[model samples]
Target: MTTPFGLSSTATTNTLVLGQKDLEIIQPPDDAISCLKFSPLSIPQTYLIASSWANDIRCWEIQSNGQSVAKAIQKHDAPILSCCWSEDGSKVFTAGCDKTAKMWDLQANTFVQIAAHDQPIRTIHYIQRPSYSCVMTGSWDRTVKFWDTRQATPLKQLALSERIYAADVFGPMAVITTADRNIQVYSLDQGPTEYKKIESLLKYQHRCVSIFTDKSKNPNGFAVGSIEGRVAIMYVETANPSVDNFTFKCHRSTPQPPTNTQDIFAVNDIAFHPIHGTLATVGSDGRYSFWDKDDRTKLKTSDVIND
Candidate 1:
């Protein structure tokens, strides 16, 4: 199929007739999954790594024969709260409630761990470039730290006023959300002194954050999730930055609200497809939705995940 943007791709999507979801199975640790991410397309085989509250991280490799093998890697002293892969997929970064971060070298079978913070680390992000290769971590200690692969400890840290909940870096921009309903967008230009933080007009506590979709290696903006079932799309660079940003309510009760009240649920996750501008979201209410932010259209909405 070809989109109006001249992008083409192949897919095998079936028409979902009922509210039930497409065939799937539940598989993972005995504890809750804190983070899950698929490997980059540059890798030969597709694999998924999931971090858990059990202090163990697991990986699943899909074989050519359609079978899959899973492996558990344990090292964290406390619950593993978040995980992310290096841009090249050579290493995986994980942070946990143990107040530490660790790097797992997949091929070398070696791991390096370090004390990351005084409080539990909530998020981890990897941005690897020829000139700059570093891992960024956000924690409940109310700070964001940057770790260089060449150093044994973090080289720089950015302090904020609230507990960090989620973070993501795309190209030269980074967006981070916190429990205080603040969304901080940073400029990843040069050194620590050159970094800039943008002001946010959000009013609800944020849950997740993700950069916008782009195949040309540049992102226009990012989306922020809140506990009130709202997603805010914010642009970093624009003629009128405030006017370019917007928010919408979603994944809540379909029927009318009660007299003088409204139903509220947390937006669990938000991800943008690389080839298309389609934004997919999951909510604590067990409902999922697909939206085209470019066109302001709701593509799909289904109550497939029962609470």
Candidate 2:
């Protein structure tokens, strides 16, 4: 299907292709993409939403044949930095350089300002628990705010030492990375208070982070990526010395036979498979790789694509 932005390829099979032999290129935003999120598992249809530097958010419904249909588009005053799908996949939450966060209801086709910060909202997430539900927004103003959509003001706000670079929340655990390479863990069950704080293992600037469950289906560990082409696997429970916490180098190119030098690229993003728990990392090298964190091995690596 051809869109106003670009032409999209239609796949023959129902499976979605990414960095594989048969790739499907959908309509892209006018500027660089800052964030991309897929619909929650509860939703039957696969919907992808992307926030871009062009100050707009675009949603696409993935068809059975890997075709992407433009579902919705919402504009913002400034570049959108991040976006996420609600637990039920019925709504989307976005935050950006405009210092505000907005919620988009897919069913009603409406947008509402849900939260605000003093500085650019860099990251956002929707948190839903049996006892409570709210939107989490992390901003460059060095604060993390939780907002109840029904009310105008934030339900809770947590101040940090430095500006937030990235954050991720899973189950009741929240991991936040700041500008100074400081990592803080929060327990939602304990009311937004700081649970434990740890210094990052990587020496370079942190880029992205993701939470993954352990064998018991509890979120006890998380992956942190840095600009130095490294990922650190950390566990929340450090009391157990038996737990394996390690860091590995990736997204780097080996030098030729005559030279021992290597080219290192920043690890742009890291995500763990919801079902299998395997991790995937995308980098500035234009390559993505899947890894088995427990086994400490790369499962698959995709060919470099020319962007």
Candidate 3:
């Protein structure tokens, strides 16, 4: 199928064209790929990490030819739902239905179950900066917990009213999405001592499905996506003494279609471009569109991926 924006190709290519283009899909192992993270270092040798619904974590080396070939890595009994590479790309962290978040030593090719979450862990991220090296996790248990990777127990757990679907660590703040249709932003800089909820925005019926911060624009601000096909730009406002001061502006809305207008169909994943200030969203409808901050117009729409 072809659209006005660009053509969709199923061919696998080792090279990325100067402009936006489709990546060849190298059939991932078995089961569905639940999460994907690319090494921040370089392209080929950098590595792409994928966690699966099949209780597996696989690392594929970006070959010299730009092709991805899966490397056998750690295997677990429960599905690996979410995974992330450390800031320095030295380690990998994964959370899963096994109810634990494990750390992988890339250099040693070993796995260590670092912290156990009460429920199926949905997301895990490592916070590394000038002052600390810690891990944060959000779970179906309706809570977010911070753990000192060096310790056996969690440093702090913030109770919530809904199950957490996803979370991201940015600088000193952590942005979390809940099943209750709220995006809860928390401060990681406060450590375990005291955590005041930074911001809570109620905007959807199916939870904030995805959230991504623009690494190039306002690295501190982020965009939230919900199941109902709505995305809002959320920014942290720390001036207020209590948390939850963060505010949001609706950036894009899935068109109540048949209107001959293009919009996000149903956001499944979102990523900020490597250089541009554009935010890319991939949806269940296989539409890939890029948008700017002001939400003025859909900047670009490229190839669509049909599942």
Candidate 4:
């Protein structure tokens, strides 16, 4: 079976290679899992962290034998919508329905809090440079805010036209997709002032965004997914720009029996393998797919997780 590490396993005793029942499974939270992220690639051992709508957060160390043991878990007052790790893996940032963003000490289990928005936060991300680190958040409030590690107040908050549905950062550039079907890009170094809005269609509501970072220090393009099962592979016009911007259909829905209509589902998440630049996407259909972006090809699609 294909392990999550992007490798095949020949070992018969590997639990991750076994059926779901054979693997070490953490007790699931009462609600849906909202986000899942791995520990920093620089770390010796990989850890999988998951936050859920049950107002719970948990982390588990991924064992070499494909098993896992819980390392930490905490319960909050409200459901957590998203979570991300700090640059050094020393802190975990979580945002939720409570309209607050919190920084948790990974080892100590203590936390500091910030009132981030008037509406529930939908996403949170952290990126660091040699000189400074920043945590960014996107909210249903139709705003994206950036906070420097040293300050409690946001350095800047940019007003988005519609509710922020998805946002992502790669190096100095970031992309924000809103409810109005606007896909906007920003320069992290330029704070909230420098941004460009891409002119796209009004058909699909963006569900997720991911930036490509393998080839260049500052990659020019990003991929965004929509509720209609399409993915937009967009390139900016400057560093400043590029010409190969396009969008395609992927993770399509199935037609209902005796009806022309099909069940539409949201693309839940998108990520590029750090080393390979291969893109992976997960959808509400419970299927996961792989794409070779450089080749503009669909590499493979897995059966629904339940199957």
Candidate 5:
């Protein structure tokens, strides 16, 4: 069978699902994937990096014809929890249960430990600015640290209300969620000070978050997902009565013939489209959905995946 992208199912064992236009990698991680990110748009080639519970990170270059070629692999002593690519797409950073974060340089082909925490690192993000560039890491240690990567110690560290659960950074804005249901917004322009602190709108534990821009492409607000199968669209400035925040239910299955209750699955991750500003979410129900946040409507929902 031949795919629309010119890939054949029988030609290579590295690819799969010819009819649906899905192509599986040759050898995936042994355990569950913790995080995945693509290279910055400035990069000409499409490169993907994935971290896993198998205690390793893998990179692949996706070709123009839909073929995927293995590029690089790096390892940690413990399971990795998060990973991100540098703004220039020249480097990758990963954090994990090993209590440390590592930087992988694609040009030099070197992997080195760049930061450490008292407890397992939960999430990491790369922040690039005109004056400086740094990696921001959140940990179960109840703190967020900013690292220069070249230094042995962090340049700045801020205490949080509780252990970090999820976080995201876009431009100069950063949003962090903790185990105690606290959400703190930060303006990196002010040197990492707390800009606003609020409780999560969801009733359960925070699972994921992503910062998004408004029509002007300015950092306006963010979307948060929770274990209760709900998501909240939040604005940085709630003082304006015209801009409102809202929550909605998703990743839930309909009741069967005999039962009146639905099965609710945790929302695992949320991402914003770079060009369109639309939102995308993936849940434990093995389904993904796209939404127009501005209109408060669901654009599309995918069928549940078997795998």
Candidate 6:
């Protein structure tokens, strides 16, 4: 996988390889990579997190040249499905099949189990604020909850009919997607207790897999990826009516894969380049493709991760 926000092109057929100029192999593991992230402010240093079906989350430090340069950074008791770093890069947030989300303080080297959802936590994002920051989590319970990092109790919660597939916060808004094939925008204006639904639509009839805000590009524009392997770009304008203000445009998917690559892949997650609007996509088939948000064109591709 392309380092979370870093850049790499791999050409591995069965092995994860760094592809632009030539082929380079990434270390092979017994388990598949469940999630990946790049270190904040760390250039060319990326973390590859793998979760085993047996309930294990393993972290590997990868160099720009496609080598697993260090030992696993950490481990968890249950199968980890999602992982994210604090906005300041000081801590890490993780969710697993254990039905709980944990906060890890790198400075303290301690892990604290925070809250237990009704089901496994699927996605999470840490919001950075000048005064205080918070972490938001999405679970299979069909609800999304916000938790204050300094406190263990949930600050607020919102319910939905279908299980939540993805959730992330941007500025004062949190965007959530559910199995109902709809994306709901919730406002944190009055804290979670009085959440006002800002937007609701079935942008994708298929399960929405990833949602990300392009704060670096346009403050109000964000993107979402789906199980059908399609992506929709949206712009959130709060000036409009309550839930009818935002407008979204579905970008056409790249042309079908070459006949030989029919089984090519699907997107796992999308993260905007910290400095630019370029998008990094990790495919289930293991190909890490990069696209320019402005033009929505493929910029680069990497080898498939070993599953």
Q: Which regions in candidate 3 have their CA more than 4 angstroms from the true location? A: 1-21, 25-27, 42-44, 192-202, 205-218, 238-265
Using TM-score as the measure, which candidate wins? 5
Q: lDDT score, residue 276, model 4?
A: 86
lDDT of 3 by residue, 256-299 (tens): 66785545344567676646657776656656677775454577
CA shift at 293, candidate 4, in angstroms?
1.9
Ranking by lDDT: 5, 2, 4, 1, 3, 6
TM-score of 3: 0.77
Lowest lDDT 10-residue stretch of candidate 2: 4-13
Question: What shift in Å separates residue 274 of candidate 6 from its native position after superposition?
Answer: 2.6
Q: Tens digit of lDDT per residue, candidate 2, span 131-164?
A: 8899999999999999999999999999999999
lDDT of 4 by residue, 1-307 (tens): 5443333333333235235444744554667899988888766787778889899887766677666656667666899989988867777888989888888786666777854789999989996755556888999999888887568789878888999888888778888888888988887664544568787643778889998864655667788888888887877764523447667777767666787677766788999887788999998888889998878899998777752
Candidate with the larger lDDT of 2 and 3 = 2
> Residue pairs in steric clash, candidate 4?
237-240, 237-241, 238-241
Per-candidate alpha-carbon RMSD to the true structure: 7.4, 4.0, 8.0, 5.9, 4.7, 7.1
- Model 4: lDDT equals 0.78
lDDT of 1 by residue, 133-156 (tens): 688899999999988866777878
lDDT of 6: 0.61
What is candidate 5's local distance difference test score? 0.88
lDDT, residue 279, candidate 1: 91
Clashes of each: 0, 0, 2, 3, 0, 10
Candidate 4 global TM-score: 0.86
Q: What is the TM-score (0 to 1) of candidate 1?
A: 0.85
Please give each candidate's TM-score: 0.85, 0.91, 0.77, 0.86, 0.92, 0.70
Greater TM-score among 1 and 5 belongs to 5
Residue pairs with backbone overlap in model 6: 9-18, 9-19, 10-17, 10-18, 10-19, 10-302, 55-79, 198-243, 286-304, 286-305
Q: How many clashes would you count in candidate 4?
A: 3
Regions more than 4 Å wrong, model 6:
1-29, 42-54, 60-68, 71-73, 149-152, 188-218, 238-265, 300-307
